[model samples]
Target: MIDGLKPYAEMKDSELCWLGDIPAHWRVKRAKAVLRRIDVRSSAGAEELLTVSSARGVVPRRTANVTMFQAESYAGHKLCWPGDLVINSLWAWGKGLGVSQHHGIVSTAYGVYRARDASGILPRYLHELVRSSPFHWELQVRSKGVWISRLQLTDESFLNAPLVVPPLDEQAAIVRFLDHADRRIRLAIAAKQKLIKLLEEQKQAIIHRAVTRGLDPDVCLKPSGVAWLGDVPAHWEITRLGRLIKLTTGFPFKSDGFTHVDDDIRLMRGINVSPARLRWDNVVRWPMSERPNFREYELIPGDIVLGMDRPIIQRGIRLAVVKEVDVPSLLLQRVARIRVRGDLNAEFAALLLSGRNFASYLAPIFTGISVPHLSPEQIKAFRLALPRAEEQQKIVEDVTVRTGAIRSAIDRAEREIELLREYRTRLIADVVTGKLDVREAAARLPDEVESAEPARDEFTADEESDPIEVDDEAEIEGVAG
Candidate 1:
């Protein structure tokens, strides 16, 4: 998967628009010419549900990470077999196409296809070729819709698209080679991810110490009478969340009243709340005309917003602090706005809630497995410790500096992972497009490549296992990118 690898011994111009050249013996064909469409729908409306992802191939939705829109029934869902191909119409441009290794059902919106003749092409080989940039580019061109990014890759369009096919044996060799290479790359990525996790933990350690205790190493300490927390500064005060903050629940805004237009006030949903921040990229809006007295729902600087549903992710709470740019936004149901009373410092309160102590308490109270939910009372019941006004500001300022260095390390590690992902994408494009010869490399792989090993980093066994119920909002809250 590098520039030094030799190209095919002999090559010819394939004369295809996306694919310029290929091995002389390889054949250039339309997707439909080499594949037949599969249109079998679930007669019983019951089957193992499946999902398609950018990195991982099609896997059972029940055994995959949380996905969007879990259907109440699969009655109209299309049936797909182990060797078939599935393409997510809306996100095909983002590498949302793959070959399924399971016999299950998928949403009707997806396009399913079976090889017209298996003897002529390998499904695994086609999987890589389809995911390669050339095919992705072709799909984008064939996609038809009003929005450029969200184009639809309909059945007819996807089937008619072009593909480059190598002989069956060579195709097998390519899959084996790429698989070995991918495993190696994924392992490296996993190590980087571990490093990032460590850095984050280091940052959190600083915050936990500063907020729970105090900045002074020799400060007199006393027990707060809480099991999770050991000792706090002798001068600090202990209180319930009800005493230190004013909490307001978001209104239940009607769905039909929602709009994407600019004239409306942005409605902050559970999706907008991420760990310690608000992501504005995919927010829905409330029409200013039909909106109720939503001004009361408007957020202001220093207010902390937390998702009432599935607020805990990987054992940490998700909080978003309102900034000037984030103002004028109204909160929607299952989300709550928090404002600290004059007795508690706002910044100190946010840091405290974002810590592990807050999450541990909520974990036992929220009952749902897939979709966790919390009542307003459960939130107010939290035990909190407060420092004098001046001491609170000192702790916030000191913790900020202490975590800054650790955060820098985490950011650098994250960037490395992104670069590695980009490289892996390019490597696949080069290999599938006949830019590199990996026959020798594929044959030289170690025996462990064939053994069952958990894919790490962005993908993992836990991430790909049975229906994860955290609450309906978890699906919207934890989207990758």
Candidate 2:
């Protein structure tokens, strides 16, 4: 589309297939020609070992799985240096590759390779090339065995693979452009992540303020003397949960009671409870014969349900509100259904259950030898600071408005992230699969290549090295230190 390059569509088959058409002066080579394997063992000592994280790449070796404190000696581990490429042999398929920038050792499980000629082939460009789908497909096809769980790239296979080489200057320019684009995308992602965190924190702050202090801040206040809730509005009453609501446990429903029926009835389980909402995707239906016993467990549109599983409680489970589709839904035995009675507001009660104040109150009360649980009596007897019906509605309305805005922002940001990821994948596919020509694409770059000359020496394998053993104790000590 720009100048100095032609489209791949006009090129003949003899010119190129995988990379479309490139400059006639360009030559294709194998990855092994530019990468040299480095495998050397280190003594078992106190040297810090580095780990490769899928998200962070090569970081300080302290986080490796081996113990670092007790080992008396150090032996055999592969040494890595700055500009060297390290990859977990078992996880290479997942893109567990990193360009190291520090002097350290890696476990024997990782493969370390150095660029044979940095000027001839840019390391960054090669790294990006290997990650492309075309290169990965070649690796997959050359891999042995039906299952590629522990596949490693053989030297022969690596040497035989074809690479699309442009002039050295053009390769460097392409790398620069890609790095800039990648940095921009990463910054955008980080900004979105920070916004999501701020929204979440704001949501929690709103709930905490509303539950602890009534909608009318100018109202007379007093010390409730309760440690969990420091103080309450003077006019508000502190009452036990038993007095304000009805707490009941659901009857035991076995797997035999489940049925695949076209009915309105659904059985609510802990799995149905998700973050801030309910998921009925795999919900099971219950028979009508068992409906009466579950009447007390029947969830209403505004009722709040809590998981009674001790582990779930320990993991900080929050109460969820029910909807119309969940009206006929019956709760399982390990779930507690709380229904507001008299003049109490159901939405307000649900809000209290959803907030930090209620969670802080209930966290300590849950106790057990093996599995912690909350009894019906305990739920009923729990203390709560209650506001008048009018004030409760006001607090609920305020929280709904604030939290609704935050939820909407999170939803939109998540969608944008998805779109960006899709665009990145499509771009890579188009470039790597010959659907687009890199030479023509390079013409759209901000700068043109300074030279069309190729480097002198190509990549070649160095002398083979022996496998190294890593000290388990020193590795642990490094992490603990």
Candidate 3:
């Protein structure tokens, strides 16, 4: 903590209401007291423009990450200059404020304002103040709209708002210190992202190895003679998918037939199956009474579900395994249930379906003009390399053990990344709004702000335009036109 700062006990009750404690000597004031609205206009074809982004603050016009067709025409927008505070009034409640560093036009929705004086209020400090929790609460209290909420902060309402301001020098120092800490956090995030990418690549390699080559590298190899598979263990047989598994089409149940029941039975559909797992959340319900010949479509432990619809088949791959032979679950028409037979291991067969070689084999068989689909006959005829059951189990075990470890590590890193992002948001909210003393920390910050540039101004009124006409006169004019 910085020197000369103490717990905010000495402040009067009215001076500090929501914020539990503050530094003894600090004074509380409203946000409007230090904020002034700056007004300027720009023509549509203004050469230089500036855009404010939710992620990156104010940035040059060309640097924004928006589709060109979606951006403002730039014909009639507001003008902005370096050092002015630009805030999106509509999005201000979400912390959409930043100090501009480029000269250009901005969206009309933004309120471009300058501080009354640098001595009393620093631009950086004010930027932080508007993002404070209390300030956001104020915005929430004042905003009004049926569906699209709008916050209209009048001059009086703004200036009368109060906040605790540290000394001018301390404010600057805090900004500098927080800036440095932010950079470190960002760098750590980048490192974790790179690690994730590398782990994913490793996972792909493991899958490719297990499916194409058996676990024993010492085993003799031979040409599977299948173009997609290329080669396999010498002892393995090249067989059509139909030979190794019984691929059965699912029963078509009408929407009217679906009933809400408190039963353990699950109806598997194309949507229920993702790449590697089953999503049971948005499942359609069916009554046991409606299930005629349910045993014909019942899912068994180790059975793999493959979607036959075009959209779902494109992401077809492997869905999930019936880990337990529990209650009867019917398969929907758009899905194909593959039950391993002959000398094939169910897990190994499922792994093959999830592997690259099988995907390559099935890709060409998908038929359709717009949404490509796979028929049961086409899927059955798909060629694959089939190893003996014992070898298949070994390969599945090896791949699962290795990939599971990598997946666990990746999941942990992803969770850490998410927490870091949340921490970053809280930290910025605190330092920027003066909730925490960050002046001493700010002095140690690196000069450069190294995140991606702000997104370009791409205001789409078609999206933001009001659906209902505000005035009867306007409605009449629209009808007349």
Candidate 4:
């Protein structure tokens, strides 16, 4: 795409420290001069409730993950019209602001603004500019707070920022060019994601068969006497999970007491659990203290950690086996840690919890509610199929080797997706800041440029949710608009 693009006819300095050069025809202006704050409040609280996500931008609140915060009445929330810019005040430093495409009621915590003059300033253009990589650093610097998590973007700090103004027609062209480029990139990623899902399903089928029935396909079968288990090897035993495992609750650490540091005590939360294994990215920490009882909470290699709250992801719940790299960490509240005892093989138990068959056992425990959770008793009461100890170990080893190949393919696809997303970000920064002129590219763009329409109201029964473009950066930053 870059090879086919051309540069501008003329150039000039932007007169801003952060922004270097720009097209000669464009002018540099302070953000305050181009936009004004809007503070309209809905008296009837009738507008659709909306959320701001770094991944999906300003969307209906229910569409995005509200696992962290339950939805309440939207009364007294700030009102926003389509084309207005909405900023997640606390997370603006992470580019958690976007142009709204729906008329809705946003949390009072957000800052809403509209263009003072649409002829020289467009909401779409402004959205791309403020979210550009350069602006991320700029917002971080201007944000006011003592710590990173608590940083806030005040109206005075946000509205006074620098902006580059272009002709309205040029803004529209750039938006169209980027929209078309973004859609193509997303379509490619969707294909890779689909492939990964199929591979996972196949891997689960392999696990379900091995863990339930013995290795020999011709082995004699007998009724397991459990409704969920139709028939198992004649020699296998049907046992309760409590007979072979000891379940422990996670430590209830105070959130306000938490600190951020590399060497501090690592706290494992639900986010660390992945389908294939545990992930250490985005770890939270607690200060190292003198309490000796901490040793009891510390995890050892091969210990089982299961997410107990809002644990479901991508239509399934995933469990993790602690490795040496993940040790020296204490589990946080809303997570369950299991210790193996008696004749059960720990590896086999962990894999069983990670399989698709486990979903049926979990279905009843996860009643539709604001926060879905499983009690310790419910986990212990789960029926377990016990094969010979030697057979259990062999099955674990066999499944590991088989699933490893599937995992490898998924990893390769994920890396490619990451690289594609990086290219998208760079392309946007180059074109939006005048480093690259895509006017010709825009003209040649396909006529079906994606519409930047907000998803349907999640609170309504008659509406069907539309697929929205999820920005890759949303992962690094927590959540934003």
Candidate 5:
């Protein structure tokens, strides 16, 4: 179906600059003409709570991370029925709105809209149309706020925005085509994700063996006393991480003092630390003039940075070794910078942290419900079975050489997944905006049983910088600008 897609034979100007030409037979209608803004309040907060996510659309609160809690008594929360459009008014610019598939209650801060009676718009079709790439620009430009992330899309603005109106039959066809494409894409991505998971597990097993049990299988083994460690080589030392390294928690730099100047020193927030990699994409900068005041927070090459908050995800522990390029960076609050105190190889320590053992140890002790966190003490308390300095260095080298191919394969799979996502994004935009006619292709698609798992897209997967959380105020609490 995807391969045979082509633009409609007859095209006409959409008049809307963002959407140039749509199918000639389709009508471009103002949103208000087809949607009625509804604000019905729940008599009692008895319905399941729902949240609007740019990644997952409207889903039940229990299915996603809960960033905030509801107040006592559910009375007066806004009511949302199945097929109703729920928009997190403050986050609409971020694609934080979608048509609900389940009836529930949402925060009062959200705007609920229903297709007007007799309006030809299909709920599923409108959901895709408004979330298409071009429509995101429409929401961003119409949203009002000083900070881009905080922009609020007023009810009137959304109601006045232009929407494409296809014939009911065509709308159904578009939805079917996109739905089928989505299912196929999900399966492809799942395969890649599974491969990555397997490769990671294999790589981790190698590291765990190298770190816990020395490279030589003939080496002597003895009870290590630590339950997680089980047994280790007789010559190895079992010690807390703090005994071998100096740990420094970041200083609390005021947000107002942060700058965007590239020449300024980069601030390494907890979010900047991903598993095995340091990400500077979302960094803040401290003024060069104020550099001398924060000498202790300065990060140097060979330092290992770890996110103290939500330190573990499904992928692995959040930690990375700093390289020469990562220098000129300062550690920010909730992140820890570690320096070897003696002969411990930094690479070996990183392997220990990145391995499954550290995560298992941290799992039972980490605190916080909405956001799990690691205190400096908790991180320092992790125990590890360490071999001699020479043995540690040798083990690191051997593991790196052995796992190189696995790492490459994981990278290739990740790149393929990225390409698939890009294709999906473009396909939705072209098909929904009428740049490509999917009706004919839709007709050719064979019957497919819908999977119980919701379709995962770029918005719903690893792409979100932060977990979108909802609180009593009906706001997405974890959005990062």
Candidate 6:
């Protein structure tokens, strides 16, 4: 839909450093001139609670996977209606602002704004424009704090920020063009994701077969008493994971001490673990001085860490193998580190934890409604049909060789999705910032039913930035605007 787009015919300087040249007809206005801050408090806190996320704008608090406790009374929380823009004042620079489509209540610390009656801005257009890269830079420059992580965007700063305004018709065109472009990009991403899923499923089948039935297809089967394992190789032994591996759950670290200092030891929270790899993005750190006090929590190469909280996500179980680069890291709460004890192969244990059977074993065992979790006991109690140590190593080696191509294919698909997302981000920035004219392209597009917006979890932050933490805002009563 964004093919062969061209620049505006005439242009003029916006004079705002953040927003450079704009179409000649466009006007630049202070955000306060175009938007009015609203602070209607919810009388009874009965409205649906909302949250502002960096990757997704304003959404229901229930949809967010937060571990924070909810306020007992939300009566004095800020009330917002459809088309209102909600900004996480504390994280505005992280792109934690979006125009809401639902009537809800937000954090008392959030700033809610609505377009003035006479303002020639569309909420949808504003949503895109503010979230663009240029606006992120503007917000970061205006925010105040001692450090980048704690930066806060005050009311005066947000109100004084310059806004690029296109004509009402042009704003609608921009919105339509970007929406169409997003739909196309999402569909492309979905296709790639589907391919990745199939490849992963195929790889899992190979691992499951090898681990369960062994390399010999015609081997004699025994009735494994475990309900999950119907039949295993006659020679295989069924034993609980605790018998072969030592499980260590992380210590309860204080969040107040969490730092962003690069040289400090990284606290390996659940967020840092993905399917088969550890993601250092969104890491929290502890002081190097305190590291000596928690020597037992230190991770080493070949350790297997699993996210006990929400262990199973759409992608897969959040289990990853610790590597050499991930050391100098201390395990944090809600993550489990498994180390080989007697004769189990670390890689083989990882295979079991990452396989489909383990996921099935865990599916029904998760306890908690808002944030499902697995107790260290539950994880240790998992029973696996095991082969002897040497045979386990042989199976791992054989499976690795067989699944190499499939893994490579999955990586390629993932990389393609990343590139598509990057392209979408660039397209939105260019279109909204007047670098590309999408009016003609929008007008030529056929009318179609817009698919439901993709779920927020499907997307990650544009950078390794902080996510919305409900506890960041105190449960204070909001005052009138």
Q: How well does model 2 score by local distance difference test?
A: 0.60
Quote each prediction's TM-score. Answer: 0.78, 0.54, 0.54, 0.87, 0.89, 0.90
lDDT of 3 by residue, 1-481 (tens): 2344323334434344455455555566655666677777765545476655444567664444222233446666677787788866655544455787778777666777776765376777666556555567765554443322244544444446565677778677766665555566767776776787688678867978887887777878898888878878887787888887888877886655665465735677664555555655345567776567677898877788875643222223535576564336788787788898888888887777776776787666654333345777887887877777777888888988989989899789867876876776666655544456654445554577455622211111111111001000000001000
Off by over 4 Å in 3: 1-18, 47-50, 60-68, 132-134, 148-163, 208-399, 426-481
lDDT of 4: 0.74
Q: Worst 10-residue stretch by lDDT in candidate 6? A: 471-480
TM-score of 3: 0.54
TM-score (C-alpha, index-matched) for candidate 1: 0.78
Which residue pairs clash within candidate 6?
A: none
After TM-score superposition, the amount by which residue 36's alpha carbon in candidate 1 deviates from its true location, in angstroms, is 1.2
- Mind giving the per-residue lDDT tens digits that candidate 1 earns over 48-145? 77777555667665544453556566676788898898887776865677898988877777888999965487889989999887777797788886
Which 10 residues in a row give candidate 3 its minimum summed lDDT?
472-481
Q: Across residues 110-177, which tens digit of lDDT does each residue of candidate 2 receive?
A: 77878786537666666666666555666666555433444565555555667665567766655655
Number of colliding residue pairs in each model: 11, 20, 21, 5, 1, 0
For every candidate structure, what is the RMSD over all alpha carbons to the true structure, in angstroms? 5.3, 12.6, 11.6, 4.8, 3.8, 4.0
User: Relative to the unseen true structure, what is the C-alpha lDDT of residue 446 in candidate 5, on a scale of 0 to 100?
Assistant: 89
Candidate with better lDDT, 4 vs 6: 6
lDDT of 5 at 165: 89
lDDT of each: 0.74, 0.60, 0.61, 0.74, 0.81, 0.81
Worst 10 residues of 5 by lDDT: 466-475
lDDT by residue (281-369, candidate 5, tens digit) is 45668899989999999999999988776677656777889999898989888789999977689999999999889988987775446
Clashes of 2: 20
Error of model 4, residue 18, in angstroms:
4.5
- Stretches of candidate 4 off by over 4 Å are 6-18, 68-72, 288-293, 449-481
